[model samples]
Target: MEYIDPHLHMVSRTTDDYETLARMGCVAISEPAFWAGFDRGSVESFRDYFRQLTDFEPKRAAQYGISHYTWLCINAKEAENVTLSREVIAMIPEFLDAKNVLGIGEIGLNKNTRNEATIFLEHLDLAVKYNQQILIHTPHLEDKYQGTRMILDMLMGDSRINRSRVLVDHVEEHTIEHVLENGFWAGMTLYPVSKCTPQRAVDMIERYGPERLMANSAGDWGPSKPTAIPDLIMEMKKRGHSKELIRRVVYENPKTFFSQSKPFVHG
Candidate 1:
């Protein structure tokens, strides 16, 4: 079954990974700006990275017949530098009009610090002013719960935010309901380690019934799998899920959420 991995860092993967993804039925993907394993020192570094995301990565994905969409932001980990974060956020608009550009995102709390929250709200303001959709990254492991709540509260406090246009990703059993019940879309990122596994993702699907929910591999430079969504598809089938139901979560749900972005043209 053809599908879309809504969140993956192709910049960290090889060309072989792209070929493998295409072979496994990944028709398209959306890559959000994330920390490049370290804190960048200047706004120029981010400017160059945005150019790579908007200009270079799309061309690379096209070589394998995979459409690439991207989100632009400084990422939460780097948000600690308030001055640098603001500079990067101000520079993001230059790429917002790019055909493959989606919006300002993967922009939530990391350690849930004051600076991160300030930057998160600033990114929110940028998205609202530009009428763009958002993709958020909640903190990991022990920090996930409180970080997710902090991110949710900030979003809820904003009257200008259109709930349907925002996606809070990396949700687990503990945080999924909070995201969906409040009317925003939720993304379950399947990973080999740390995040939800294929079986667990299927369980969440069973419990939630698939409305406003989607799954992704979130393949990055770490120990992750680019084909984890296919793993979820296989697990769903093994558990006797109908093909239509599987298709809705893996394919249709992402399409529906992304269609809200002007740059995303459904094929």
Candidate 2:
């Protein structure tokens, strides 16, 4: 069963991740901008980071028959430092025109604080200006329910953004309805900890029924493995989900979401 991980952070992963993912029938992935596990001190840092995403990783992924796609935006946790976030946002256009760039993403509130919200709105404005698809990373743990609500509200208030073009990610049982109810695409993160696990991801599918949904392995600077995409695929199969269901959730949904950025991919 071929799959696409709609979200990942390949820049922080090793080549072995590519090999394992390819062997698991992974065909494509979308990576969102995320914290580098430390504070990046300069705009040049982000520029280089985007370069790595567009240039370095794609070549490595090609070796394993996996296509690498990325979303360029300043992560919300780091957005607390507004100045740095703006600088990173400014540098996004240069990379957005790269061949593999999907859109502006993984940008949303982390601590669910006011400043992070402001930065998230700014990021949304940038995405709208470009007519780009958005990938949002909502808060986790205790903050998730409210943060997911806030993220959806912000998008709804923005007359310029279509709810269908936004992917509210890392949703769980509690937040899934809110995302789907608003007609926005939902993304489940299959991680070892601090997010939904593979079993729960499949359960969510069973409970909610898939539509505008995608799953990803938010593998990154932490204890992450890129194989989480295939992990969920396996779980879905074990749960007796049909091939069409898996295809719609993993491959077709992501393709349709990212294809909205076709101009960016060619520009």
Candidate 3:
């Protein structure tokens, strides 16, 4: 079953991980700009990181026959440095036209602070200005609910945003309804710890019925699995889900959402 891992930080992954993903049927992946485990001090650091994402990572993925797409932003954790965030956002335009570039993403609230909200709105503005699609990261654990709400409110308040073009990721049982019911796509990240597991993700599919919903590995430098989507495929099959139904969640759904980006030319 061929699939797409829509949100993963390949920069933190190894070449062996890429090989393993390809072996497990991952044909394409979209990496979102995220905090590099620490706060970066300057816009130049982000500029260099963007270059790595747009220029280097794609080439690396290509070695394994995987198409790599990317999103740019100063991630919420770093967005607290409002001045630096704005500078990084302003510099993102230089890479938007890159063939592998998707749009502004993995952009949403972390701690749901005022500065985070301000930077979130500014990233929204950048997305709107570029007519780009968005990929959002809701907060973790206890902060997830309110952070998701705050992110949604800001997005809903923006008149220029087309809800369908936005994806609110890391949704759990409590927050998935709000994202999908509001007309935006929702993503369930399968993780070994913290986020939804393969069984839990399959349960969400049973409840939500897979419309405008997708699953990802969210594989990064932390305790995550790059092959989690494949695990999800097996779980769905074991639960008697038809191949077509499982395909819709692991493959078709992401293709549909990511196709909205001009640079994402479906093959």
| Candidate closest to the true structure, highest lDDT | 1
**Runs in model 3 lying further than 4 Å from the true structure:** none
In model 1, which regions exceed 4 Å deviation?
A: none
In order of lDDT, best first, we have 1, 3, 2
Clash numbers, per candidate = 0, 0, 0
**Model 1: per-residue Cα lDDT at residue 13:** 99
- List per-prediction Cα lDDT, in the order shown: 0.95, 0.85, 0.94
lDDT of 3 by residue, 1-267 (tens): 899999999999999999999999999999999999989999999999999999999999999999999999989999999999989988999999999988998999989899999999999999999999999999999999999999999999999999999999999999999999999999999987688999999999999889999999999989999899999999999999999999999889999999999888755
If both were scored by lDDT, which would come out higher, candidate 2 or candidate 3?
3
Pull out the clashing pairs in model 1: none
Q: Cα RMSD (Å) between model 3 and the true structure? A: 0.7
Report the lDDT tens digits of candidate 2 across residue range 23-110. 8888888888889989889999888888888899889988998888888888888899998888778778877678887789889988
Against the hidden reference, what TM-scores do the models get?
Answer: 0.99, 0.95, 0.99
**Candidate 2 clashing pairs?**
none
Ranking by TM-score: 1, 3, 2
Decide which is better by TM-score, 1 or 2.
1
Task: Give candidate 2 regions above 4 Å deviation.
Answer: 263-267
Candidate 1, 2-113: lDDT as tens digits: 9999999999999999999999999999999999998999999999999999999999999999999999999999999999999999999999999998888889998999
Candidate 3's TM-score reads: 0.99
